[model samples]
Target: MVNIGSLVGAGGPNRGQASYATSKVAIASITTVMAMELADHDIRCNVIHPGAIDTPILAAFADESEDESSERTIDGVGLQIDT
Candidate 1:
C-alpha cells in the first residue's frame, strides 16, 4: 500500500498540529514496515510527503492577490510508482 502525507512528516513548518504531525509520522513508519515484510512477495509500499500544493482547497484560503495571480500554481514533487 502507498501512503500520501504532508511535508510536516519531514518536520517542516507547522502550527498547533501535533496530532496531524504524529499521524503522518506513523504512516512513514508503517510504510517502511510493509515494504520490508512484503519484499519477498514482490509487493511494494511507499510514502509520499508532498510540499505546499496550491489546490482548490488551498486557493479557498489564499488571499485575493494569490487567487488572482495567473502564475499561481502548485509546486511540489509527485510520486510515481512502477509496478
Candidate 2:
C-alpha cells in the first residue's frame, strides 16, 4: 500500500488546518500498522510526505514563481519507511 501524506502531519503546523493534519497523521499511523501486520504476507506499505509542489492545485491558491516552486519541491523531504 502506498499513502500520500503531508509534512504537517509529521510535525509542521498550519493554522486552521488541524483537522487536515490530524487526518494525515492518522493515515501515517495506519500505514505503519498495515506494514507491520502485512509483513508476514510479503506485502509492503509505505507513506510519502510531500511538500509544496508546482502543481495546478497549488497554483490556484498561491502565486509562486517557477523558481520558488522548484526550490520548495527540491527541498521537500524524501521517501521514508520503517519496518
Candidate 3:
C-alpha cells in the first residue's frame, strides 16, 4: 500500500525552504514514479493523508481551561507559531 496523499503538507514550517519542500514533494513524486514503473507488473499505488489527527504537538495545547485550550493548537503551541 502507498500513501501518496500522505505527502501532503509533510513540509512543515512552510517558510519557503527549497530543500524542505523538495524533500516532502519527493514523497509524492517518488510514489508516482514508483507506481508507474510497477504498473506494468500489475501493481497498484495509493495514498492516504490523515490531516490533523491527534498528535503530540496538538496534545501540548490541551489545558484545564477549555476556553484557553480552544485558543491553542498543536502548530500554535509554546510561543504561538502561527499569527
| Per-model RMSD to reference | 8.7, 8.9, 8.0
- After superposition of all CA atoms, the RMSD between model 1 and the true structure is 8.7
Report how far off residue 66 is in candidate 2 (Å): 22
What TM-score does each of the candidates earn?
Answer: 0.60, 0.63, 0.48
> Residue by residue across 7-61, what tens digits does model 3's lDDT show?
2335343333467557656776777788899999989875554454455554554
**Taking the tens digit of each residue's C-alpha lDDT, what string does model 1 give over 1-83?**
77997777765434445798898888888889999999999999989987766466455434332433312332223422221
Q: Please say which candidate is ahead in TM-score: 2 or 3.
A: 2
What's the true lDDT of residue 55 in model 3?
A: 53
Give the number of the best model, judged by TM-score: 2
**Where is model 1 more than 4 Å wrong at Cα?**
55-83
Clashes of 3: 1
Query: Which pairs of residues clash in candidate 1, taking residues 3 or more apart in a chain or in different chains?
Result: none
What's each prediction's clash count? 0, 0, 1
Ranking by lDDT: 2, 1, 3
Clashing pairs in 2: none
lDDT of 1 at 20: 83
Q: Per-residue error at 7 for model 3, in Å? A: 6.2
